[model samples]
Target: MRRKKQIFLSLGIAIVLLAVTWWVDLWRNTEATIQVLAARCDIPAGSRIEADHLALISIPASLNRAGYLENQELAIGRWTTGFLAEGEFITTNRLHDRARGLSYPDAALGRRLITLKLEPAAANGFWLAAGNHIDLFLIPHSQDRESEMLILEQIRIMAVLDENTGHRLTDTHLATTTGRLICLDLNVEQAGLILGRLGSHDIRMAVVNENPTG
Candidate 1:
């Protein structure tokens, strides 16, 4: 009888120990969380990180080691290297400097940023912004005999320069005028072709695509 009683005591202790362990695990899963910032909305690549786009989130500590940003201040004003979705954790590896905007052309290998001059009338009527693709048309000096032939197929506009100064213009107010310049992201040979013809040929722009690039 004593042996049976000892067996029951051991079984009871085992049950209690299992229950305690289960409870401890459940509590830890709920309580052990790491605080981090995540994208509150879809953030486009190359966009400067804004406070409204971020949200504070608490995720399990074990998963947080996967590389999540903890400080909100550190993320603001930094340009995103790629598109990040909502609820996605902002990692340290995907940010770039806004002041150093050189990475825009780095997306396309072997492409160099070059400035191209076009008459406001030939261009997109002073409405072009960055990421716009335009086909180049060459208008000869004599208008009587020849037609304007397409010189280039599709050249991506990297940026639009200010009307007076050479500063980069934002899409919000790409403020266009007659002499506004456009920065192109093209291959070395293509850049050379355009640069050589700028003074001689009457180059014009025909908008192919106006979508914003990330």
Candidate 2:
């Protein structure tokens, strides 16, 4: 009976010692360092990045020696770092930070702003939006004579405001009823030419299909 008790005590002591050793190893292993990306390295947009560009990400001590470690791959935007959400992969090809060419002429000071009113029959079904390029069609007539049509291509649509209230088209729901006042990015002289020709004939809008690279 005494021998049996001694054997049980020995087994319990061995189990305790094993548990302590495991706990120490677990604490030590919790100090692992992981790789994380940082954005302060002057990484410019459209610059390709690789794993080497990342900085080390440190795990908390509490999680270090848990016998399980997870390594994740991350793609971060330029000048950014950290674990990205799932399916959020970043690349240079997808970044479009460059200024659009259509908005260029208006960047100058003292630029002329011209409002062109479009009736439903004239405004291309009122399907125009800001930032769209259009070709202007004008019907011209000599006094008491049949009118001729003139086509001006490559005009820009600045805004589609409301004609009745003279307010900008703010609500999409009021679009069909508000009537459209189209702002054309034209020079003072050009605007005058188009406005003078408005009623003599008819005005129409056409979409301008420009090259994407241009």
Candidate 3:
């Protein structure tokens, strides 16, 4: 009878110790965090990652996983394959290292990619580049002198192309380029609206704030 009592007591002690160890592990995981690279602003597709575009963010160590780039040097110079919102985690699947000729990203489900040729002034004197957000406005051609309407708000520019050669232009070469073009990532409905106004209405672009919240 004494042996049975000792066996039960021993089992109870073992179980209690196991539970305490597990609780300690869980608490440590909850408090431990590591820094990871994240987008500082809205990073549009096809844009090369720069030091200023990234910010270090702290996340729980337990949430860390493979394929997430933790070093800023690893991300710099890599081109983004898709739009990354501010504070979004940078991952290997969304970036490429090769500088091969500009390749348009496949439009995400429920989204559409559209390119439009614009006058240098319409493209903000060719100063705009990928990752910049713009507000699009249209002036109707009606004889009654209709007011300019704001067609789109906070649309992201995906890439800037040379109108004459149809090649992507970098920021350094934009000054020498005569005509400029811009590609936009938009929803199906917004794409249709812009496409329909291509010939009839006078369209213009206004660069908006880089940080939406700021």
Candidate 4:
């Protein structure tokens, strides 16, 4: 009877060892995963990151590294420092914080912000909004005897404002605001070109493209 009891104890010990081995192997083979934020679609450089532009994805924890954003709130309302491909992980270095409330865009750093006050009729009937690309035409004061010239093509609209209230309008607010003022993002040369012609020429704008890729 003692021999039978010892045999049963040995069998129990063997089963316990087997179960531990199996669990260790399973743990070793299963990869740990972590969630990170990624671009839901191709995001252009200098474009604002909206809620729809982000997605949460699970990846092997081994692949997770510092600077990767884990929260959506951290990305929304921020602007991209450079273009991000779809499914690419969002990192801290790739985003520019908008909370600084700078009068100019970080993406337009080293560039000039030029504001143009348009007549109610010249404001594209108030159809233009921020992020739209426009072409500017110059009517050369009729003194140069030159035909109307295309001064700028594909210039990005930085902001639309209600000239009367001096309030900036974007998205839904754009519909309610009378956008008679527009701010343009231009390089030094482009700003100079527009500034040189401003007083002498009657400038008109046309929306050539909307939300153009970087």
Residues 22-104, model 4: lDDT tens digits: 99989867978788999999997888999999999987788876658989998899988887999999999989975433345
Best by TM-score: 1
Each candidate: what lDDT? 0.77, 0.60, 0.81, 0.80
TM-scores of the models, in the order given: 0.48, 0.42, 0.46, 0.46
| Alpha-carbon shift of residue 108 in model 3 (angstroms) | 2.9
Model 4's TM-score against the true structure: 0.46
For model 2, how many clashes? 4
Best-to-worst ranking by lDDT: 3, 4, 1, 2
Tens-place lDDT per residue, model 1, 1-214, is: 9999999999999999999999999988777787899999998777899899999998878887768889989899898988899998888887776633435633486677877666667776767788778887766665565544438778888888775787777662343453678787878887777776665568888888544573
lDDT of 2 by residue, 70-152 (tens): 33243432333223333332333333334222333443564567887777767766676777789888866574456566777
In angstroms, how far off is 60's CA in candidate 2? 45
Q: Residue 123 error for model 2, in Å? A: 0.7
**Comparison by lDDT, 2 against 3, better one:** 3
Tell me the TM-score of model 2: 0.42
Better of 1 and 2 by TM-score: 1
Write model 3 residue lDDT over 47-163, tens digit each, in one string: 999999999988877788765678999999999887899999899888988644345554455567889887776767767788788998876776464645647988988788777
- Model 3 earns a TM-score of 0.46
**178 Cα displacement, candidate 4 (Å):** 3.9
Model 1, position 101: C-alpha lDDT score: 47
